[model samples]
Target: MHRFKTLIIEDEPAIRKELEWMVTQKEELALTAVADSVAKALDLLAQTTPDLVLMDIQLEDGTAFDILHHHPSPAFRIIFITAYDHYAIRAIRYGALDYLLKPIDQQDFNGAIERLKKQEVAGLPGRLDIARQMAIPEKAVDMNAQICIAATDCLQMIRLADVMHLSGEGAYTKIFLQQGKRITASKPLKYYEELLPGENFIRPHQSYIVNRQYIDKYLKSGILVMRDQTEIPVATRRKEFIINCLTTLK
Candidate 1:
């Protein structure tokens, strides 16, 4: 019986140990390398070409996306491990990639491993591209990065810099982009609030989240004047928080 050479990339000490133990339990798997940060992971990758990579989404230095970006076409299969990051998990699922949430369940881990053993590496690059585009970084929010938006007819990839504002309409979100382009996303405003980088985006009202870069001015009468000339109301409770965020930007 041939054992699959596996590489573990995780930062948390407890989880890392648990994963190592779990991998040891699997007779088909052989733990080849373990890395706690992006730098170490990269160094290990340069040295070893493992059959499978168990990667955590966020590391001390950077994200798993950074690692993926570095190696655009990796030979090994990947099973992403992350916390309850709605956007990251959603992106992985959207890409049809395997992911195990934190506090890893034994059954789920077994299932993901079984699936990986059965599947082929065909179309991995395309799936990875989709995952990279849609996965949001937990620490650094890059304004220039592109995010995948699920529209009614199709999935649209929109750059974070091009987004002007987001408005909530019941369960859906209406994304206002540059040059008067708008897209109705299947997800709600709260989903975007969590996904978007807080440094560039702010929730001035429950119904609206505006990009700080596109704000023309803040009115004294509890309103925001956008560069596109759209007036968005400010919630009474969020007024102080919004003002503080804007002040820091200036």
Candidate 2:
């Protein structure tokens, strides 16, 4: 098996140590270098060319984007590590880049590495550009904002405004859009509920999240009628809250 040369860039002492241990534990990965800040990462990048870079979003001096901006054309694949920046996480998802949340789980880390190994390096620069653009707070929640859906075969970037509703199917999410199109995303509905803007999207039930723009009417009998004539059940506990929300929208 070919071992990929890996570099870790993280500022937090505990996280950096944990990441280093994880990388070193993987037989298919070779720990080439580690950096605690953007400057140190840039310096390491100049000295060694790693096959994979596991980097955190925020560093001591600046963000990981700072390093990428300086090195316009990088040869390595990137897997972002973040604690919880809504815009940044959305940006990474929209760009179709892999990411691991802070206090990383070993299983998730391994899965990310395996997925990176299987993916091709084509179109990375363009994806990175999209990430960089969407990372901007103002642009992230705009009308033209999009979310990347990981389908079985391909990644689909769908405009937020185009999404009508999302249904949870165990571990997956079924996204309903205009023109009767549907996408089965690998992520769960809860993932989207948190990622989407709260002003436009609302969770009426544990298994369903609907876009306010697509709602046609809410019946007093605990049902929401969508523009496409789909009837979504409003949980009994959420009836009052949902009704108030719809009333407020009117």
Candidate 3:
């Protein structure tokens, strides 16, 4: 088995250590080098070409884009690690790049690794345009226009408007779409929560996130009925927030 040659670029010591340990845990991933600054990252990249790079967007001297700028067309794949910045996330989404929000979950990290493996096998193209768009975001791809779902067989891109809701299935997720199409993805629901536009989707329960556009009505029994007549239970704790979201939409 060929393990992925990986590089870690993070400034914070604690995060770097955490990520280092995490990388070590994955037998299929081999840690090639570690860099704490953009200059160090660039220097290391020049010396060797790793199959994958886990990069932090915020560096001491420069951002992850600085490293990307140094190598316009890089051979390796990139998975951006960023703090919660809505604008930056929008750019990443439009650029069609994968990202993990701060306070990273282990499962999410593993999911990203799995995604990188798929991208590598499929020779996924770089989304350097997303980094550029973060600076001058003009003519960005519409957020609600489409969504990419990782199916059992492959990555499937479908219209966001067609999705009715998402159901959590432990490590996987079941996406309910229009025309009664249901696809199972190899990632958790939290992954979609971060990827999807906030305005379009809302989590009514720990197990369910329903699209606002597909909401038929909120039943008195504390269930949300989707356009496809699927009854999604509303968590008692999330009921108020869900009501507010529904009210705001109206």
- Provide TM-scores for the models: 0.58, 0.88, 0.65
- Model 3 segments beyond 4 Å from truth? 1-36, 39-48, 69-73, 79-123, 126-142, 236-238
* Candidate with the greatest TM-score versus the true structure: 2
Better of 1 and 3 by TM-score: 3
lDDT of all predictions: 0.87, 0.88, 0.80
> What is residue 11's positional error in candidate 3, in angstroms?
4.2
lDDT winner, 1 or 2:
2
The residue-by-residue lDDT of candidate 2 on 43-78, one tens digit each, is 999999999999999887999899999866678999
Candidate 3 residue pairs that clash? none
Q: lDDT of candidate 1 vs native?
A: 0.87
Winner on lDDT between 2 and 3 is: 2
| Model 1, position 25: C-alpha lDDT score | 99
lDDT, residue 11, candidate 1: 99
Candidate no. 1 TM-score: 0.58
What global local distance difference test value does model 2 have?
Answer: 0.88
TM-score of 2: 0.88
Error of 2 at 226 (Å): 1.6
